[model samples]
Target: MLQAFESAAFAAWPAQQSLDLLGWHLRLDRGYTKRANSANATAQSLPLTASDVQAIENHFRRSGLTPTFRLTSFAPIEDSDRLLDACGYRACDESLVMTRSLAGFVDGSEIAFAPDAAAWLDAFAHASGKRGADQAVHLEILRRITAPCAWAVHASDGPSPACGLGVLVGDQLGLFDVATHRDHQRRGLARMLCGGLLGWGARRGAQTAFLQVVAANSPAIRLYESLGFEIAYRYWYRVPTT
Candidate 1:
C-alpha cells in the first residue's frame, strides 16, 4: 500500500509536462520543482546502464535543466542507487513518506475548497515562497491534477491565508506542496490542514492519507508523528556530485 501511494502520489503531482524516454518519465516544468523537472524511475522497465545515464543526462542538459533522479524503494530498477553512484551522482533531501488511517470529519473551518486554480495558486505561492516563472509553473501543475482535488487554505484567523496544501490522488489522499507562510510559523495552521484534509478525505470515501516530508525537517516530522503517521519509506534525489 505504501508503494502504491508512492507511485500514485507522483502521478497526482505531475510536472507542467512530461515525456517517456527509454521507458522512463522525464518530467519538466521550467525547473520549478524537483518532482516536475527530474527524471523519474517509477515507470522504468529498462536497466540503468552507463549509456542510459548519459542519455538521461543529455536529455535534461539539452533543455538547460539539471538531470535529477527520484529513487523510491519500489523503483523498477533495483540497482539504481549503485548505478547512480558509479555515475558520480550524490543524494539529497532524503524524505519520509508517511501515512495514517482515515479520521472523522475535522472541523475544516476557513478551509476553502478551490473551485479552480486561482485561489489555490495565490495561497501556494505565498506559502512556498514562489515568485515569477517559478510561481507560474505551480499554477500550471495545479491545473494538471485530474483527480478530485481539494486546494485548501487555513485562514480562520483573518482575511490572509496562513497556509495552504493540495490534496490530490484518490483514496490515498496524496498531500502535495504543503507549506505555511513565514508569518504563521509557530501557529497550528499546518496541523489544521492535515486533520481537516483527513476529514475531507473520509467524507469523500478515502480510507487512508499520505504525505512526504524531508527527513531533516524535524518539526514537520514531529507534527506528523503526533497525527498517527509513520514512516512508510524514504526517497531522495540523485544528482551529479559536482
Candidate 2:
C-alpha cells in the first residue's frame, strides 16, 4: 500500500526531469520542492551501496542541485538512511502520509472548480501567496500531470479564501497544495475546500484518498483526522550538512 501511494504521488506531483539509478529515482526541477528534486528510493531488492550514493550525489551536483534523499517507509531503506547519516546528512522535515477510504465521504457547500489550469494557478497564487517564478514552476508541474485532476477553490465576495488540487490515479485520489489565505483562515474554508475536492474525486470513482502534511502542523493534522484520515506512514528527507 505504501509503494502504491508513492507511485500515485509521483504521477500526481511530477518533476521536470527524472532518472532511474540503483533503485533510486533521481528527480530535479530547478531545486523547487524536495519531493521533486530529491532522490527517492523505489526498490529494496537493489542494494544501495556507498558508491551508488556517490553516483547519485554526483548526478544531482551535475544538475546544479543539492543531493537530497527522501527516505520513506514505502521501501526498506534503513541501511541507506544509516549510510546517509554517517556521511553527514542531516535528517529533517518529517511528514505523514494520511489516507482514508471514501466509502461514505461527504462534501459541504458548493466549491467552485477552476475551468482550466491557468485559472486554478491564479486562484492558488492568491490563496497561497505564492507568485512570480514559483507560480510558473507550479504551473509546469500541474501541466505535466496526465491523470484526471480537479482544481478546487472557495471564494466569496472578495478574492478566493482557499484552493486545492486533487489528482486521481486509478481508484486513488491524491490531494496537494491545499491552502487557505492567512487572512481568511479559521473560517472553515480549508475543510470545505477539501471536502469538495474529495467529493469531486469520489464522484469520479476514487475509492481512496491520500494527502501529505508536515508532522509538526498540528492544526492541519487535526483537520485531516476530523475528516476520517489517519497517518498511514511517515517519510523524511536527508540533506548534506554543507
Predicted candidate 1 versus true structure: per-residue lDDT over 1-242, tens digit per residue: 65578567767887766787776778876887787788876644466888889998887898889999887766667677789988899988888899887755455544666557777777667676776766676777777777878777765545344545545466778777678878777688888877777777778878778888999999999998998888887778998888
Off by over 4 Å in 2: 43-47
Model 2 deviation from native, Cα RMSD in Å: 1.4
lDDT of 2 by residue, 63-140 (tens): 899999998876788888998998889999999999999987777658888888888898888998988877777788
Clashes of each: 0, 0
lDDT of each: 0.75, 0.89
Q: Candidate 2 at 125: error in angstroms?
A: 1.7
What RMSD does each model have against the real structure?
2.6, 1.4
Maximum-lDDT candidate = 2
Tell me the deviation in Å of residue 188 in model 1.
1.5
Cα error, residue 208 of model 1, in Å, equals 1.4
